[model samples]
Target: MKNRNDKQGNLPPEIPHKKRFIIFLSVFAFLSVAVLIRYAVLMLRPADTENTGNTKPFVERGPILDRNGRILALQTRLGNITVWRPDIIDRDVLSRDLAPILQIPAETIDARIESSSADFIYLKKQVEQSTLREIENLKAEGRLRGVGVEAIVGRIYPEKRLASQIIGFVGNENNNGLAGIEYALESELSPASVKAKGGSGNQVFLTIDSNVQHILEEIGERIRRESRAEAVMFMAMDPRTGDILGSASLPNFDPNDINSSDDISRMDRPAIWAYEPGSVFKVFSMSALMESGSVNSGTVFVCDGHYERISNRGERVVINCLGAHGRVTIRDIIIKSCNAGAAYAADRLGADAFNELLQNYGFGARTGAGNPGETVGYLSPTSRWSERSKPTIAMGQEIAVSALQMVQAASAVANDGVLVPPRIVSRIVSPKGETIRSYEAPEGRGQSRRILKAETARAMRSYMVDVTSDIGTGWRANIRDLSLAVKTGTAQLIDPKTNAYSPTDFIASCIALLPAESPSLILYLAIIKPKGDSYLGGRIAAPPIREAAEALVDYLGIPRGRNPQISHPGSVSLPLPISPVVDAVVPNLEGYSKRELLPMLLREDLHIEISGDGWVRRQAPPPGSPLNSDTVIILELE
Candidate 1:
């Protein structure tokens, strides 16, 4: 190395280069170390000081709509008030500050904050955005610490308690369904269900007619008040389509405040509750006896207040009637609701045949209403029947059935012996309004089957028409010039505590098939444990059934010319006006509410993409554009 020192007293250029490199390295290492220290400090910091956690992934859930496109349940963007427990910093001060904002007692807030051991907890959910802004402002001012908020999807029920028992409420645990349609159709309405099928799902449409549902609720409320019963239930269905048009249960709860509702208020009595149907069961029994060729309309029996018979095992069975008739025909027995006469008729039908008929009529099986907690009503097989079983069952006692089951059974009678299975859901549609699938009963289900001869059904209708006459038990149900086949029932309730029938507890019920000649609507009503001046079915349940029928008849326009249903499978009827089918071109959707646009959007041939909220302000290609795969009707809402 020629000389380490530079010439003319200058230092070596290499020395300066090495010194510069060392200095640059020292600076870089120091910067790296500083960065590492800062990162470690952050990792060690307490989470309370940070506004983290409490964020639930925002996934869209489908809406619940009525058959007519009325919104029943929907999801909206809302905020959740969250708090960092450790960061509460000052529990007393924070609770005091939050008390006014949360509209709760400061003591309550204080207790909540002190009870939690978690680093984070939700103070409240579904808080309004405007309300959250106030909280955020207070937190930024250092007045409220350890407080955070998460934007969440909130469920809302616009109809309040209208169909609470049927729609069900969502539980806080993962927002799963707890009961009603919400529970039954959970897989179709849940976020995970949507993901499993695709990215998003179509809305769920129920066959429930909102107007008719309102009518049932109105009439049922009156009956519940007048009878002072423990509870009441009313359900109406279309016998032709098995569509439940209206349903109402007393003591209903508002799903919006489900946490505050009691168990009884949330119960869907029509589908879940079972009771002895009393005289109404006679209708099916008489129909069965007549159809089986065991008895005819002119078949006569003596009822001297009671009927006594000897069992095959030598046991004696005796049943009492409401009144003694010396000689009664099958038609007279029905008109008078004679228990003894019915028992005599049942004796001729034989136990095996009667039980088989009841089972075939769907007595011992669930109505398959697609609802949860439905009881298949108790109908013991002939093998399990006691000596008194036949007579007791003929009088609508000793065997239990739900209101929905009764409706299904009556639908057969009104439908001319063609059993139409009941269905609650109509179809599931994509958000763009295209139908993905229909809920029609598969293969054997929802399909009609001949259960009895049309001639027998007509004779039963004639006897039922007399039931609304002046001397009939269902006299209170008479409407001038309104033709209907009706039956009334009253059975003493079996006290659960004693497992014995209690005289003080009785269920009054009534059923009607309108326009007796060619019935389409079937209405069933029951008042449980009625305590009034009169507890008879005619006095307690008949008038309300008439009122409901009148309202529904007007609402449904039932008097219009109609075709009688066929007994063959896969037969169809035009009982109601069908909604117009969607054409390939876009229809004019202007001046329609967002809710009204839903039915049109549900057309399978249309692709609708909605933007913003509220009514439509602008749309692409107007209303008559020829739709195509690339055609996306851009809807701008204001």
Candidate 2:
């Protein structure tokens, strides 16, 4: 025992066990205090931590604008009314109070709260600013404890039903695009930068001019209503750049009121709907045949009302014609839209060769125009062709096509042999209007594909010009003093139940090129299953084409022929009317040329209807008239 005590004393001075235990406790307590202080420092600090320094605030979705910079679709700050069940002091009172402000039934709100499985339920979504203000006011007064308005960015279409299918609608929950250009360019339109530096998505500018679109819609609506057609698609394009100027599909729905519309009304018919185009396709067929050296301008065929073909199976195949035309040349085939003559011309080429030529014209494939649900339009391959397929396809039977495809195919003739693929989106730009990306067809992709020889295209245009003459099928499409090349089609609709062409139902369609020698515009109109006394394309569709051309000619300032130049006095200086008026009044627009008032046409706030072409001859609002949103500044030019 002595040895153990002596060894322990030699090691160190002995302290009380209680003192040693207190020392350890004090050390631990000091460390705990230090840790608590550190935690408190971290907790009390601002959220500018190293990790959070790079975090970005949420950004709003960008706007979709027309080619003229008119807002088609834009995001608005919308509030969604939500209910927290646990926080609700009085569910009955909350529901009753919220009902009228939300434009909802009180009983319905009450029923929703009672039936809800979730503690939190959305009472109403997309609450207007006025409505949200009311709810917010009540909440400020402690009237609504559980009822909260959560802020959300929502899409709003200011133009309503105008270009609805082209702009498309987003999902209610995630705001993802469901159709049209929205769906096709989702990444470009959505605020994807929220994950990075946080900025608005790139703005998409379409090639469609709102004024031109309005004109087409006005005409298409009239055609649909007067003809009692099932549907209508009227589209216009610049043949040079393939920029779609206007596209209007009837039975259009307002994107703001999408829930009230169905899929049929929402369909982008010009891009998505595919049907068998009749004689209008003859132009393409003849072009293909002519390009292959199978037919020429001088080549002639005899027609006895219908085309007769002998199949390998010893079957008689017949494709009827609109008229007998005793003898027809390639020019007559196009001018008269003679199906028998077209079939005879097609017979000169082999099956594979004919199909290949048509395929080169952007048939049997998507035009890559950036439409989401665009159909390839059923053009069967040579392998799938029957014995009667050659002649049948020649006269625009059996093969199906879309209005977009028709426009794209016709560009070859209009562009003097170059095929320009249709492009709806002109460019994608940043929120600040900086060009993010410019869109154009890639090389080796029909950007410069000469689908026809220059001579062949010229010849084709010349033949199509005759179609607008008094003797041709498209004579009704002619405009006085303006050279127009036109093609009219009246195709029979196929009955789904019968799997054959419907006897009563027909599609009346027309395609026209203005200033036939050097076309600047191509207009296409199709009225499907038109119910009327007359279903001929010339009678029903051609007149609309003429009306559209006449308006477009004056609106676009296309030269109606060479006019004598009138010299203005050099001493007389007049300021160009840029802004309408400082007070939003209709200024003195008289004596100003049509070009002077053009800038006013682009204003979203003003609706100016200009008729005729020279200097301003008359004004509706008069000088210094207060211009409101509904004010129509009518300018008549001479």
Q: Give one digit per residue, the lDDT tens place, for model 2 in 211-322.
A: 9999999999999999999999999999888889899999999887677899889999999888999889999999999999988877989999999987779998888887
Worst 10 residues of 2 by lDDT: 565-574
Which ranges of candidate 1 are over 4 A from the true structure?
1-57, 81-124, 128-150, 196-199, 441-446, 560-638
TM-score of each: 0.74, 0.72
| Model 1 agreement with the true structure over 1-638: per-residue lDDT tens digits | 55645445777667899999999999999999999998887688775444355544456678888889999988777778888876667888898899989888999888877788877888887776677889989978887888888766678788988878988878774368878888888888876876634444458999899888888988888878877888999999999888998889997888877777998989999989888998988999889989889989668889999989987789888887777877888877877889899988888877887888888889989878777899988988788878888888888998999988888888888877888878788898877788877877433453667798877787788678778766688878877646678999889998889999887999989999987766879999999888856888988889998888878888887762121221222111222212442346665665443333533443445567876544567888787778686777878765
Model 1 gets an lDDT of 0.80
State the C-alpha lDDT per candidate. Answer: 0.80, 0.83
Give candidate 2's error at residue 585 in angstroms. Answer: 60
Clashing pairs in 2: none
- In TM-score terms, candidate 1 sits at 0.74
